[model samples]
Target: MISKQYDTIIVGAGLVGLATAYQLLKRRPSERVLVLEKEASVATHQSGHNSGVIHSGIYYKPGSLKAKNCIQGYMELIRFADEYDIAYELCGKLIVAISEEEVPALNNIYNRGIENDLKGLKLLTKDEIHDYEPHAAGIAAIHVPQTGIVDYPGMANKLAELICQSGAEIAFSEAVLGINEATSTTNVETEKHSYSATHVVTCAGLQSDRVASLTDRGNDLRIIPFRGEYYQLKPDREHLVRNLIYPVPDPKFPFLGVHFTRMINGGVEAGPNAVLAFKREGYRFSNVNVNDMVDTFSWPGFWKVVGKYGKTGMGEIYRSLSKAAFTRALQKLMPEIQESDLVSGGAGVRAQACDRDGNLIDDFNIVRKGNVVHVRNAPSPAATSALSIGQYITDQLFVN
Candidate 1:
């Protein structure tokens, strides 16, 4: 097997991993870094498949890692984009409460946004909701001026370019097989090569838990894959959404419900209902892996999650099978939208972390054991918060 040595070895070449390498090279220009990706190129999964929304830290709770990284990374991302000439837009977004039942949750989100130090937040009345999104129906709304969209794939590619220019090596299609930690160096064995590094950071998204378990045996968390299915509006129907229109998310669930997003490139995207996936990277109902299913079913937390969210899970499955049900969910936000207005779009699988106690971790869970750091759970806003998360990881490696 080919053997190599580096100052740091980072697994997974997604946005976060690439950003980590970028940050590392920026800080210590002389340090040799190597990034390994299972995919042929960067941003093949979560980082590339997301809605591309630059979250304004409005939905996350104040003082949480998600909030801190998203807010800080938002600024850094804009700066990076500006410096790199990547295409992006600050079109803003609206979170609407379609009924009185959702009003309290909307109010709470507004308060959280304020506590998170977001500026230019406006709680709008029913009439004012039309002022931002003319076709959107709601009892109340919160206009988040900072939320926008960007080309994440493009950004990921740019980071890879910058990292390579700075002398870091990125090897594609190298799947990690094992990680062995010695007294001073960590040896990482991939499918084709064995390498050694002083420190290893695993940013493996869907396969994070499995990768982390290679070194840390007592990992208490299991990654439960949830496939978020989306639909794109017909070309003629894109006008229904001005920028982005969201629903007041269910506080019980980590997912923000089905909504509409105006893509930074073009067209409008609707949907992304959270449904349990049979495969870790499964993007469709027919995509199933027996091993992945076995891993999920074998976990005790999976059963508890199913027991608690059975009804919601069934609803999501129903929507996945029936397009009319999905349309109805979107109609709550835009009354004029019809079933025919939407065409099939893409899907992304979120790697959500679940503990033995049956809790779906809501924060960015980064665990450090010995000289290795594992990003156990980083879903939405991760792409937006890539730079800050990278900087944070860099700090962890150097400081503590």
Candidate 2:
């Protein structure tokens, strides 16, 4: 039987929300916890469609939420995989610098890794680079042994299974329409039914900003969706990439440049250049949503981002449209790669947060408004840091 109120209600059944529910139920097994998801199943958006890279805290600033969570979550994720018999590998990765100009940025990344307390980080010479990846060509590279890959969607499904086994209800295909915060309880109204809870935690991914605004109308933050398109290497060409290979990212932008990733299931994936999406959930160039486009155009931060990174953005657009352009970018690290070696693959939309001032919010932005907690911004390492982020949110709920 459904109760009028639950001890806690979590919105969004992505990895973060599911992790939060799992931790909460683990702490208080008898507490009535319920999870609500707009999609018919969990991990349908960002969590399900990510690159599946277990980040090594190399790019994040020390002490930032991203850095801390990624480091702690990396350990927790490996441990959980071990206990649950999930398939994951510490295959490691190489952040290659093809030119002398890129060496400074590469050094900065190494320093960040050191500051973030990562062990077994090595600086590889041009000759030594081939030791790990024979096809990779670079002037210098940072070999991060902690970097790895896994089947994230598989992990998420297992989490959902565990959540149900632990006696929690996960209602899917129930889109959240509004949130009404009262003195003692919060009411979450969906398309089909309504749920009331003492406290509500929303980890809505793509619709995070909009869902958050349902409760607090004064929010200045908006979600700007960016589509990342990927390409998979033909089976015969998979050997060109051993483990994972990445370029030293530009310091000015938040995106990691195109490279190669050896998936846990087999085969290699390459090239995910970031581009503006026409829809909030837009996966392809043709998949356009008028309202989503209008929202993006009306946002001040969106234009500011376009103006600031226009050149880079245009380059990304070019790469997205031209297979040759994307292959050329990948060739920086692996010169052996040819255009014919690539084939169309899946794409994912990132729910990037931007402020009213036209600034893209970088860190993990979680805000607590009364009894409602909102995860305003969580990108790249979010999937890798879900457990830690969940634990952090779980801690906040205990104090309340």
Estimate every model's Cα lDDT from 0 to 1. 0.93, 0.91
Give the number of the best model, judged by TM-score.
1
- Please provide TM-scores, in order, for all candidate models, with all chains considered together: 0.99, 0.98
Q: Candidate 1 residues 234-310, lDDT tens each?
A: 99988888999999988767689999999988999999899999999888899999999999999999999988888
Worst 10 residues of 1 by lDDT: 246-255
Per-residue lDDT, model 2, residue 18, is: 93
**lDDT value for model 2:** 0.91
Superposition TM-score, candidate 1 onto the true structure? 0.99
TM value for model 2 = 0.98
Best by lDDT: 1
